[model samples]
Target: MPTKELSPTELHLWNIVENNPEKIAKMSIVKLSQYAHVSTATIVRTMQKMGYGGYTSYRESLKIRNNSNSTFNVLNEADDKIRSVITKNEIEMNNTLHNLSYSTIEDSISMTKQAKIVYIFARGLSESIAEEIMVKLQLTGKYCEFHSDPNIIRTIASKIKKDALAIFITLNGETDELVAAAQKLSKNDIPVLTFTTNKAGKILAFSTLSFIGYKSKTNYFPEYEVRSRLPLQIMTRIFCDAYSVRANFYKSN
Candidate 1:
């Protein structure tokens, strides 16, 4: 399933469903919301974000049974575990590709080609993807500024010109610094482009164009702060390649 990074509350609700699927399937939306200690709206929104029509649809989906073995089974053999990991990654990439919009990509490339300057901002693991974009654009003779620091991103956002373009690479897309920067740039009428896993993220509201990517809902390491960056990597590769083609074509003309 194509998934997204969930908020703490949403994650808590998901945990309940994951642990007690039959129980959730039996409960009404109001009952589930009360049991989960969240509002009915939260329940509906979380279900919708998970690709369900609403709470009713999600509950119905839970009722459908699959007799196959659990994908999270602890494999006895090392090779089996390796294959499992590979299979999961393949699924992740496939879902992300399926979610991509060709027209949105073409629009992003066109905006990049027309911008006076391209400002890229990212934090944590997302910085690598932003750097890749910067390097690719720079190689095509486009002037790009890449910032990984939160303070610098906010500062640049405030001072950036109207003709400049801003791209934000974030997994959850709810980072305070990044959202603040996006809001500032948006208010100034700067073109903002964002790549994120969260379709309901605040940054999307400020974005002139947004690319949504799929993230695995499974948290393999619940104790650690690790999450897969595969979706972002795949989307970045596509965007950079398309932008490069357009940039080269414009130069040739």
Candidate 2:
């Protein structure tokens, strides 16, 4: 576990868990709160401060690690690392699915189907994900454009038609310029959608509809990835499928 300065309540909970890891796997949030002598809200806030989205995610990760054959071997062997990543990604996907709002996904698919054209905005590694969306959407016969350059994105935002839809992909939703441009499109009455981290952030606030995806631990060295974005990739694929289903369903009607 990563070490950081902890508050008294957090420390108490940590000590109990550290001494009896097995007990937590079967414990609910309410049970854990009672065992720690803390309120459920405090437990939730403590988890968030420790980098988890919520209690469920925190507990799931702990359970996954506990089940692993050898935690220390995770970094010692390539095979172990691969296994570890696969397990963690599976957990993340389940967490994302459990938390997803079906209505929001339906709204996003409906918006895409109704749009005359689609604009995709992403940068760096996320640009590939955006490109995939463009390709899949275009295959459905919807006109699409992808933008990575800030100037071009802003230019398109200013001139986008009201019937068009904009989809932005940002892992952290901390890209100030992209958020600004998306907000502009919202102001123009052009529906804006986004794919972002599970935790709430700026871009999500203005999106006409948004899909939350799994967020893995941050990689300090860009060249060597310690966590995989497979969960997010699966989410994009699911979104494409949903778009196709909605389009065909309406067409048959």
Candidate 3:
């Protein structure tokens, strides 16, 4: 938090960005200079000399640098503080992973036993994971499928029987189109499950269950962005395993 020991250019840029990242996040070098003590040429030259393509790339780099810095600070604050202070984030994330794995398994088992149709809805990166979930759950011989596009999802939702279940993945839990499809399914007496960062969002109300996780705090490190793909992937594995075990048990019974 202290500005001490920062390079002169770093200090200037920090001062400009620290007060208003919203505006700074959208500024050109000329605008940035008007907001800071640094000049336009100084901004461009320093940025290029620092190996940036231009001021914009350099400004984007600052956001990564700041997130990394926050992660560092998170690691530095007393170990006890870090341990006990779940920061409203860690709590939500861990809870989400736990609840999803358990409930999804239960749901999968019940669906399998009853031969209920399954569908998954996820866009963006998690769409791939949803595909995998569908495939793995498909091994139980339940008719499971998913589509990443809202148009396709809506079509499927319309045809899903009243006994079917769907799991919709929205990392932020605020996708209007995705939640709309989920809502449509719910209105027809179908069950919906949601995976997101905010269970309290409208998706939760639309779904039979909602899982919330914050990927923000866990995705960066000093000097680089350490991808959170592993943790997310591992959780996905747990979910599949739980589902598989339950599904197999039902088959044997």
* Pairs clashing within candidate 2: none
- Find the 10 residues in a row with the least total lDDT in model 3: 70-79
**Clash counts for all predictions:** 0, 0, 0
- Listed in order, each prediction's TM-score against the native is 0.65, 0.61, 0.53
Q: Tell me the tens digit of each residue's lDDT in model 2 across 114-156.
A: 5678889997778888999999888888899999998888787
Candidate 3 ranges beyond 4 A from true positions = 1-108, 112-115, 218-235, 249-253
lDDT of each: 0.76, 0.69, 0.59
Candidate topping lDDT? 1
Ranking the candidates on lDDT from highest down gives 1, 2, 3
- lDDT-best of 2 and 3: 2
Candidate 1 residue-pair clash tally: 0
Taking all chains together, the TM-score of candidate 3 against the true structure is: 0.53
Per-residue CA lDDT of candidate 3, range 7-106, in tens?
A: 6876677666656766776765545666786544344444434555346555565677667332111112222224333543454345445444332334
Q: Quote the positional error of residue 55 for candidate 2 in Å.
A: 29
